[model samples]
Target chain A: MKLPSLRIYAFAYLAFLYAPILLLPIFAFNDGTIIAFPLKGFTLDWFSQMFANDTLGRAVRNSMIIAGSTAVLATAFGIFAARAGTRFSFPGKGPIMGLIMLPLVLPEIMIGGSLLLVLLAIGIELSILTVILGHVLIATPYTIAILNTAFASLDRSLEEAAYDLGEGKLSTFRLITLPLVLPGIISSMLIAFTISLDEFIIAFFLAGNEPTLPTYIFSQLRFPKQIPMIMALGTCLVLLSIILLTIAEYVRRRGLKKTGAKDTGGFL
Target chain B: MRRSTASWGFWKTLRATSRSELPKKAPRAEKWRRAMHLASFQFPLPVLSSAMLRKRAAPQETRMAQGSPLSRLKHSEAANGLALISPTALYAILLLAAPLLTILAYSFFKDGYLTVIHEVTFENYKAVWTDPIFRAILLRSLIVSGLVTLVTVALAFPIAYFLSFHVRPDRKSLWLFLITIPFWTSYLIRVFLWKVILGYNGVINSGLKSIGLIGEGQLIEDPLQMLNTVGAIAATLAHAYAPFAILPIFVALEKIDRSLLEAGQDLGESRVMTFLRVTLPLAMPGVVAAVLIVFIPTIGDYVTPELIGGGKLPMVANMIQAQLLPLDNKPMGSAIAVSAMAVVALISLAFVFANRRYLRGPK
Candidate 1:
């Protein structure tokens, strides 16, 4: 309760969170090869090398491909499911919806292991495609859960008005509902994107031979000198994730406000 | 830890008990419906229609059982929901169940060198349960993770509380966003940073020595026993799982009515006392949820423990992974997986119970 203690503890914890992240750019700009914090002159060589290195380049490209595919696939499933869940008074809805949300609670290792078994059983090659499928399955639940409130918040009267002018269900959904929930859709997509990009266990098992960014990082840790470059990459990723997730939290709040749902969670 | 508990099969039986509503909806189609029910294909669409019929006839049930609509809705669509949710239900069932079943079967089978010939034997569990290494590792994991969860929650609570209660409303949104930013970054990167900073030529070692706080380079390669010990493992895991812990706690704290805390203060309680009595009680569910969020995942988490626990402390998950892969010992691995699941399931059940109790109790 004391102001001084609060300030001290808060500062210490914040430093704990930020200090390692701050090191990323420092060593990244260092003229010397070592990462330890002695005075090293500045250099952009590592950043330049980060751009030029063939393996890192391939890994980054692969990561982009995987992450992008994962985001789209996850969001698409989320949309249909969320629509069904929010609008219709359907049978077995609660249980079906719960089933969709199971992956959010179930252990990732179990999911990853089973997926690996099935992929192996069916003789599907371990590749980005399989990884995308697994990510979509896991990430869709989160996408749907977040978007459920968004879709549910929209007034059915608006859709009925569209219907009054002779608009069909599909047309009314497009013209009226889609515009109302676009921000929610966008936020869900970004959240799904962030989740997919950072996911490891499924990617680890299903990634066959083509490595992802996380996988690449995992392999690089086996070598000592690569730690600095990894830190640089990590620093960039931390900034990027923070930015995207911030946007997600913002859009989530904005979407809720736009649709006028009482903020149970508000922004956070 | 071998928990054999199963779902209520409650859904399956619910349909069988609710035959009264079926006749009213499909008086003409009763035969086909009955046959379908017999076949156990009482799927989703039928269930929905049945639910509609049930809702229409709800007055009678309301008078009879004195139940809420939500509870009645359970019986009407129980079979159909189960059938409709079958694909996903089955997916989870197969995905989680099969490997665990494999583990259970293997735990009963003897471990072999190259070829894992499946013969039923209980010797593996007997051997594993008695081993000192297993006992030590298991205890070490529990103690370290318990400490980590405590520390993480203790550390995260105030920040979450501040961001929720004290920060300006405008800045509150972005600050919450900043809290989750670390989550999206590579966990390996953060753990490795700790490694570098704590190493001999690393930041802490050289910086300390230079400042005359300790002798030269004693920090780094001098076996870093402390750096990579249980302490580092706990630190890294707490760091990784803090966001998870904080989110729930923040949710709990944010959802608390501010007036109540003020009311406590108005009634002559100090701020700290008010927090302990009112705000903290209201946030108990969140605190429990936070603990579970950190604790459940921390159990199977091999990543942080592997990186930071160094070689001295191989957690259960690491041992299981070792067996499943290079060791070619599926049986032992399955046993480990099953046991770990048992531990997780127990914790998860307790967490749910605690959450329910807290939500319903005095606060």
Candidate 2:
């Protein structure tokens, strides 16, 4: 068809994708109890109420802890897997990597349900720690995908030269390989943090009586009075996600440049 | 070609270093150099051409004969690789594989009063398959996911095509970044926002009422009643999965050689015909991928149904959740989970098989 029509269609599709999210800030600032039309003059009461809520505060704290721990653990595991898969030949590599990536396609409900059963069967109490375990399992695949590119694009001669200069394997890796993939590591951590922060299903199933940000939002969604504050919270989360993703994309591109590799694509 | 040049530089440096530092152990150093060469050659980089792989394999047999089995096992690259990957592997086995197995095993076991019994039986699966409620929910889940996949992939194709074919190369990444931003945001919030837009007395209804379209006793008696419907659920899921559908199609389109399109035109095919015969077929693999990527996840989506459907239209996920948690029927829930997964896997495999011609290796 015509290019102009196609362009309009693209823009309209984007609007559809973004319309609900854009409505968040609009309703968040509206000075009204109920979420409806015909603009109720602008106000920041929701934001203030969101700030002053103690449960919301606790939920935010809980989410930060879970996200932070998930980021570190997932990224560390990603580094190990990425380094091994990219740099060495081994038996069962296909199946091993496949198993690691299985969570990507598996349903979140399945993962959450299965994990809940296993944890209960093993006598482990559902808590933020259990949520972390689920989050890390899901997040590690993404980190591995990102880090694999970072590790694969590296110049093998750089490491070989360090080894030839009498550096031990561990020292050579620590000094050379670590710095080269540092940006990728940072990108992976940020993405993992974002995933854990936004995750709902697993956290809902695993976090027993604990209020992570998503579960809190899910609970308050049913209340009309709490909807506006939830919108305010949603606005903040959308902004935070955008910021984190932008940084991740920037660092990923910068890493590609530093390694003198071509940019294929990124999470963005 | 670049790899060969790099390898040349590496060998030259290695030989120069060994000659200068270890003159007395030249033979041993030569053996080490050969072993290093074999090590490097064994796992060629991802970008290696088949010709390069064949050339690199010539000296592997000699290297394998030079070392004792135990000593080689200790020094082998496989040993190092396995050691490095052990932690991640163990974690996956313990958490992912073990849990999945537990779910599978539970599907066969019987549920007891507030607890699962150790006795194994097929009662849960029998119930899941025989129960009309379970069957209807599973069917609805399939229909919703299929609708989502179709709508998402169809809408995404035009945009992905525009970006790949019409947009400037310099601005493609900007378009992609814009497309993906919504997908990265909080999914719970996104689903909730849909409720605000589609709920009774929501933005559309209230806006219509203010404009004198919908009212108590005007042109319409009640609101549009958009929420708690299958259409709303499909629309929400379609929006959520749009970027995923776009990316793969865009990648496939980007891989298409422009010269082929020109060649098709030169062969007297019309623009529409060229697109239909050449572009569409070539993009099938991506379309298939987009289908699976969108279809599989939406089947398991919990938030969209719960929020948009208002708990009135419970999909398989909700059914499983109800059985497992509120009803405390572990065996039934596990059976439902396994059954849903089996259906998804079968459908995905069928799709891939149907499209195997397009997905075959490039000539």
Candidate 3:
């Protein structure tokens, strides 16, 4: 009962944080079309409608493709930058890293607008590929942030030991360094995938005719009839995100334990 | 120098002699010196001897004894690091830096019928600055973001304090995970859900009616009009960014030395006074960071204002989007974007400068 007021306040704040998201499932299964309150019988019609919509399917497929490609590409780039950043001291390192992490602070609208202008001027077609390009630009910073921890916590002597045992640099990296940071790499990819999947502004501007999940949801939000289906979709997305983030947190913690590094908290 | 020709006994002898001669250092340094010795022995060269091995093993001596600056640069660790990071650095420069510079350039150019004229002019900036609608939206964006930042950081501090100080260490990550779950979900959906909850016949109204709080004959004539207002926009943003605010403050609170508070108490100060004098000051950096994190992004938030405000109350972001896409005025959009960014940067820099005292010193 100590600090009862503060504890109650904290719980209330958590409730506020979760209230809207907790509404997703309630409306998703509601037997009525409207999202208002009342005792309506439970039904799964929204879920069925969400699954049967061909456009929703297309958007899902497109989002998965974009998220997958972005995760891999951003994580690959992250590995290079993170390894170099942690293992070696270079000239202009600060500014180089700053430029790479700039997207973290810059507004997405600015990034989206600027990139759109450049793509148009260059005569490039807008597609999921361009969306991937934009996603990689933003997601690489997060990946690098994750991988930096992974690389920094590593014992350098392990790689040197492999080299001393007559292994080449590439083999030393492949055998000694890869296994140690594999958990971190997975964590980075999952986070990057989640970011790309949930992203709306960049995809809206970049995906000319294609429908990603967020943009599709945005489009559907305009129609009153699509509310329940969108709610169902939101429930599924929220569930998927929770799963991904859980796995990411688990892998990151495991990586910390494997490296014998102190737990400094994680992305979650 | 070939590894095939070297014997274990010879290597052992070499290590013994070098270890005896070299000054004592940390074990890691000793290991590094051994690795350097091993590397020199692995070099493919003729006429290798223990003297050459000793000379090569002492990297500082050999580095000082090397040739020209360009040749030195070729083999320098900086060069290797640069080479390794080139792929990522190149992508950033091409994608992020180039596009940003293009936006800056486009902002100054003349807007043609459909095509952007290459002629550089300040008319776009002039128009953007002088427009009443742009000014109103920009001001609204600033006010809404500031309000959200204030509310979010205030609300987050106590929770962050609870997590950092009151919670058991073993369960902190679980608490953090739970807090961040809603943040990672689809933002568009979250914003839309706010509209569903706050609309005229939304959850609150219906719930109130069901409980007999409001109806046709009740004191209140109509369901509360919550949507299409700045307060609704701010509330939605504050909810979305709560975790963003909590994390920084929690980190700052975690870094404080517990002994400081105990020492303050030992000096005869009450708990409240000790907290006011010791803990709050130490947590200011996190507060400032949380402020910037919440404020910067929320000002540019396009979804919340569009959905919660029902597109009737457009922020700067909506204005920019309108100009760029719907209206096809690239120069004007670019100008507004640049102006908004400049204002945001100025405000952020000023805030940082004012709070620079707390930001200094080792974490």
Candidate 1 lDDT, B1-363, residue by residue in tens: 000000112223335334545656545455554654544333323334446434433443443443676666554333333433455445445544554455566667776666566688877777778878877877777787788889989889988787677666766655656666676566767777777676657777666656655654544434233466787788777887777777778777876888898899999999889989988888887788788767766766766666666656888777776776668576776676667667777867876776674655332
> What tens-digit string does per-residue lDDT give for candidate 3 at B225-338?
999999999999999999989988898899899999999999999999998999999998788889988889888899999999999999999998999899999999999999
* TM-score of chain A taken by itself, candidate 1: 0.88
Best by DockQ: 2
Q: What are the per-residue Cα lDDT tens digits for candidate 3 across A3-122?
A: 878878888988988989999999999999899989498999999999999999999999999999999999999999888767665556656777877787788998899999999999
Every model's DockQ: 0.27, 0.54, 0.50
Q: Given candidate 1, what's the lDDT at residue B281?
A: 84
User: Lowest summed-lDDT stretch of 10 residues in model 1 chain A?
Assistant: A85-94
Candidate 1's residue-wise lDDT over A38-149, tens digit each? 6579777667767777888787888888888878777777776666554443445555565566666565665665566556645789898888877877887777766766
- Model 1 spans with C-alpha error above 4 angstroms: A1-8, A84-99, A105-107, A261-268, B1-124, B216-225, B266-268, B351-356, B361-363
Pairs that collide in candidate 2 are: none
- lDDT (Cα atoms) of all candidates against the true structure: 0.68, 0.85, 0.86
A236 Cα displacement, candidate 1 (Å):
3.2
TM-score of each candidate?
Answer: 0.80, 0.89, 0.89
- Quality class of the docking in candidate 3, CAPRI style: medium
